[model samples]
Target chain A: MKSQRVAVLILAGLFLYLSLYTWNLRTGHLDALSNHTGLEVSSWVLRPGKWVADRATTLWKRYVFLVGLQRENERLKDEIGRLVLENADLHERDRTVNRLERLLSFDPPVHWTRKGGRVVAQRLGPAAALETVLVDQGDLSGIRPDTPVITPDGVVGRVMRVGLTASTVLLLTDPNSAIPVISQTTRTPGVAFGRGPGRDMVVEYMNVNAGLKAGEELVTSGLAGIFPKGLPVAVISSVERSDLSLFLSVHATPLIDAALLEEVLFLARTRAGEGH
Target chain B: MLGPSWWLLYTFVGVWAQHFFPGMDFLAPGLLVSLQEERRGNIIWLTVSWILLQEGMGSLFFGSTLLWYGCLILAFHLGRGLFSSTSVTLMCLLGAFLGALHFLFTLMIMRLEVMAFPFERVLFEAVLQAALTPILWWVAHQLYPRRLRSDERSV
Candidate 1:
């Protein structure tokens, strides 16, 4: 009688669980509930913890790591002086480009606003099965899902999910991440698919005859409607002719290391005619 | 009051640990501790809270965590019939089982959701989960307030 009771309980529980799972799958109400509540509370906890850690490290570095501060300041000053000169030259070129575009009656370029955010955590807990990082900006900060995240060096990833005060970024090296890219010089287009973390992404569907070469840069082609055009994505590492397939077998290294990212710039597209 | 406070503190620290040690579940040991205390209310509360937190934080579907904790509860019940509930050996075995379960469950869930997953990394996390679960259980068990011990309650 006792054994029968346990068996019956197990069957009943399994039935109930399956029903809940199926219902939740059909309607994402449970997912949203968890995201809003659990994800929010987690961000609340992490933000303060990260802030304290950053403050402590900053305090120590400012007070104790002063051996070459004077020398670094002098070096930066010289670089800034050179940059100011370069900026003036670039401004002149920009004015000429605007004049040429107006004369040709070209469409206004799309403007992307850059908002900075700090990395709060990476792949937290068992549920963080993907290669991802949590950032300190979210829906409230104008970051929606699929917002392109990049650093000065290159593309980072895009916002995968957003809470009110935080968001999860799917890194470029995650298996699920794919981007449409074109070779910088050859103008050859292909889809770059991430293999996994710590592995180079593979570029697929490029014609075997395309003139892609090792060490060539790949930039976003803006075909996906997520990432903007001409943003640097990766550098080609290898290219080979596959006998069985019509496309070239190619791999490229992402310019930015996801693990080393401490900050990122979220790019929000707006109408260029609206004026910044 | 004390029980809720303790769990709150554990959850905070667990989140920090989870951040540092990505892809690992640090709060899993707490469930066992709750089970041993025979606190039915706390067990239900912890399971629901953890499931919500994990589902929100994780990239997988919401039900993965529900199945994970459900498996744990079932395992505990089954294991209790054979061995002492607090036995170190039993804890180690349960940990290993959970480790394997983590890998299998993740793969199955990811596939069902049509998401690509890093099998190699998940496997590594599984091994780490097996090794750490027992140790974490020991630490959590030791830290349990004596006043809150189930044995201390006068029936």
Candidate 2:
């Protein structure tokens, strides 16, 4: 009799909780409950764990893992020394090449101020939300919305939202993302828009008559005023023309895999009027 | 006297585990507490505290943890008829099931909220969480052997 009474009371409580939760969900007021207190409390709780983990990692690296790492570090140091010597040789060669280019009156590439930032957080929303990543740089770091983010390989994304100490980057694979691009081979202009994460972006607004081929390189057109001109964006994967449509359907894979990126360079374009 | 200390320790471990391994259900300790305590008030308090912790740590909806605990409680009650409450294997299996259920439930809620679901990544996380829960339960049992024992004891 007592057990049955307890069961009934638990059920009643469950029903009441569900009703309130559903009401909050519909009204979108549930987010109001997700204040900074929860974040702070969670951070405090996790800090000790993180500290323990760090200590464990340090102990492992210093005591257990040092033998192999020492050899690898020595090898890496030798390789770096060799690379430094090679870099000096290359610098001299570059100076000669630049002198020849100046004599030939060739135009140099556009220069932009670059800042490096670390990826602090990723996919800050629910499962079905936009593909976004947060960096450790913000307004204090001169990071603003629409600033083009890149890696050594190619274009990564652009800053979408800025906070005090962090900024959110909208990856190129996000559905809402669109960038002006040009094919290197055919010199055809088009707009590349993301299909979704893990999918190739579709290049639209290209003339049906435009001769585009597979394996052609795609670069930023600088028409959008966000990404600088001639930055490598993607390599053209395929191109198709439909009899029913006026625009050619082209697909290109992004050069940067945003999921694998740990660090990125933010390109803040200096206006012509501003002295560098 | 020791109850609050145990709660604090478990809560700290749960939050830490969740930080290192996202999508892992750190609330398994709370479930063990609820089952062991059996009192309605104790269960309610444990569930509420866990819900708050999960909501604060997770980037999901506000009541997601509440809904998850509700489902877990129902499952525990249903499983009580089939398996002994003291069985470690039963607890492990329940943890695995709850892990998968958590992924599916969160996915459904995200769909309702009109969010884009990354199916492959979420599924992978669900599988990982399911696999890890049993191991985590084993660790929890080792740490709180007396509390997790099936023998009747006063609070």
Candidate 3:
């Protein structure tokens, strides 16, 4: 009994030391080690479960979910047709603006190398750490690292890491993540930063007098050219004065569900000449 | 068959289950603690499997689950004398409290790296834990009836 007690005490000490060490670990050592091990071992083990989950999702999509989606699609098609006819006049105006921009010496940003993919699975919460989506596109689809991903609505994030068959999106909401942004109405510029633990998008370092208002829409300021400029980032949710600094404390909710997005566009735009 | 140690065994099982399906939020570990009074061989096996699973998951820190489970089990083993498992209701409450304890501990440890502390997230997790712990405790109790009786044979 005495020896057992002593052994338990020793074990306890070792664990405490280990926990303390890991608890304070800021580097990526642990994550890397896990990945190396998990890659080699758990993939085979988890294959069955992943397969089942994938099949279930696929079956649901093809059967029970598709009929309603088809009906919804048809309805939307009708609505779209009606709207397109109604908006013919607006399209003419848009053409005029495009012509005027060309005539007035403005260069419109172009979309190039647009690759499409379906989101296969969402990485488990903090489970994936970086807001990453496992898309079914890879080298075959020409998806590459640093590709800007977007939805029909707005910018999602960028492709950070890619596997042969899958790629991980480094979400704009990751703490280490940032996007160049500008106010659509006034061209006020700032950097959009992720509020970690999945909070709203926030922009920082704008001058206190920058005239930011609640509900003002923020777009990807083309200043960086990394993003094709003018992608909607978020709307100003809150703006307040800081006690210690001249910069205002500002918050904006992201336009896209970084976690729930299932389809995205990968812009294979090279980081050629863009810094914001 | 393992008798009184079944809860401990299932806790280990929870860890193993995490290998297949990610995101139980240490529910397996917490359930293991409430399942029995102490750790045992099966419990150790369960923990190891989970550590391997989490390691394999490619997204978590190496040995994160091992460090967490090992530390908590050691602590709980020493501290078990302070709590009574007189009944299943009490056992569940104990289990839930422990589950909550683990969540708080993790948050404290991870807060430094945390840039955004969304309150909704914390609240959601807490509520999920509270709701799930008793269910897990009940299931564990069923698996190891002796833990509920508290007078069964050791093995």
Candidate 4:
């Protein structure tokens, strides 16, 4: 009887396995269901925990991590004082330039509508080869998948997945990430692909004779509709020619330090009919 | 007796822990509870819940957890005569072995190329999960309510 029961259980298990396998392939309803419920439950559970962590982190930063903060504040104050004076001089220069522009009738550059949100979670393990960070804003805040996520420093990444209350931003350093970029100095265009996490991105398909030099800035080529043109992407760190491959082996470092990103700006595209 | 609220709290904590600490097998408590109860209904419910939680949190293709739990149940039944079902050591060994097997099986089922997969990192996590399962099981054993303890002993 025991042997018969075991055989029955094995058969049942096999049946369930095959069913799930077929179901998984046919309709991705499982993923949609899991994603919705998982995000909801996880968000609810993490709310209180995040509050506690935030308080503890604030306390530590204010009391324990404040030793060097004072010196840093003083240095920043002096730098700000100098910048104010320089800004006044630049203001006069900008006025003269504006007059010249008006006389020449130059059109103003297009402006992007942007929203700000905080990073809530990160997918940082072996399961995800594509490095992604979850932000607290979603469709409710006009955050759409493929929206450019950036910071003051430079381009961070583009939104990949959007939930109801949260969304995942695929970092530029992810293996699957590719961006069309151009060398600021050489004006030569190439596709920058993420090698992996914490590794220098490679700019592939560039001609070996492009004479791309190290220290050249790489910016969005505007060819890809995802990112705005001229947004800083990476700085060329090395350029080499492979004997076997036809493409040049160019490496560049991402401008943004993804590890330290706490908050990001979402550049939401405005509809054509919408007023600026 | 542990009521439904207690079980809900336990599941909530288990899900939360699994989300934050990916490699840790929080499902060990459910496994222990099912084994101790020795009830077919209990086992089925626990297995279903575990599969749902794992599939929800896991970023991989769906059905990974189905395959994992299927293998785990098979292993339990096949080894029932080799060791007592209540043996914690056996549970730990099985947990470790199954953790590694699950990773390998999922990779294969997903059709992930070997060159692209992070083998070392996944292997390290699997091993860590194995080592940590016994500790979690011990914690679950200690925290089980008195009524459940009596019921388990009576069984």
Q: Which segments of candidate 3 are over 4 A away from where they belong? A: A1-29, A36-117, A120-148, A158-170, A173-177, A194-200, A211-217, A221-231, A237-245, A248-251, A266-276, B1-42, B52-64, B79-94, B140-155
Point out the worst 10-residue segment of candidate 2 chain A by lDDT.
A100-109
Candidate that scores best on TM-score: 1
* Candidate 1: residue B112 Cα off by (Å): 0.6
**Model 1 RMSD vs true structure:** 7.7
Name the lDDT value of residue B152 in candidate 3: 49
Local distance difference test, per candidate?
A: 0.85, 0.69, 0.59, 0.69
Lowest summed-lDDT stretch of 10 residues in model 3 chain A?
A38-47
User: Local error of candidate 4 at B1, Å?
Assistant: 8.4
Q: 3 or 4, which is superior by lDDT?
A: 4
lDDT of 3 by residue, A126-244 (tens): 23334455566655577766778876567788876554455557678766568988887766788888875357877887678788889998888766556777778888899998778
Q: Which scores higher on DockQ, 3 or 4?
A: 4
Distance from true position, residue A157, model 2, in Å?
Answer: 6.4
* Top-DockQ structure, candidate number: 1
| Clash pairs (backbone) in predicted model 3 | A30-B62, A38-B56, A196-B116, B11-B32
User: What are the candidates' individual DockQ scores?
Assistant: 0.70, 0.28, 0.23, 0.25
Candidate 2 C-alpha lDDT tens digits along B38-141:
46776777777666655644554577667677777777777777887657777777777876876787777777666556666677777876677667766766
Residue-level lDDT for A118 in candidate 3: 65
| After superposition, candidate 1 runs with Cα above 4 Å error | A59-111, A271-276
Better-scoring candidate (lDDT), 1 or 2: 1
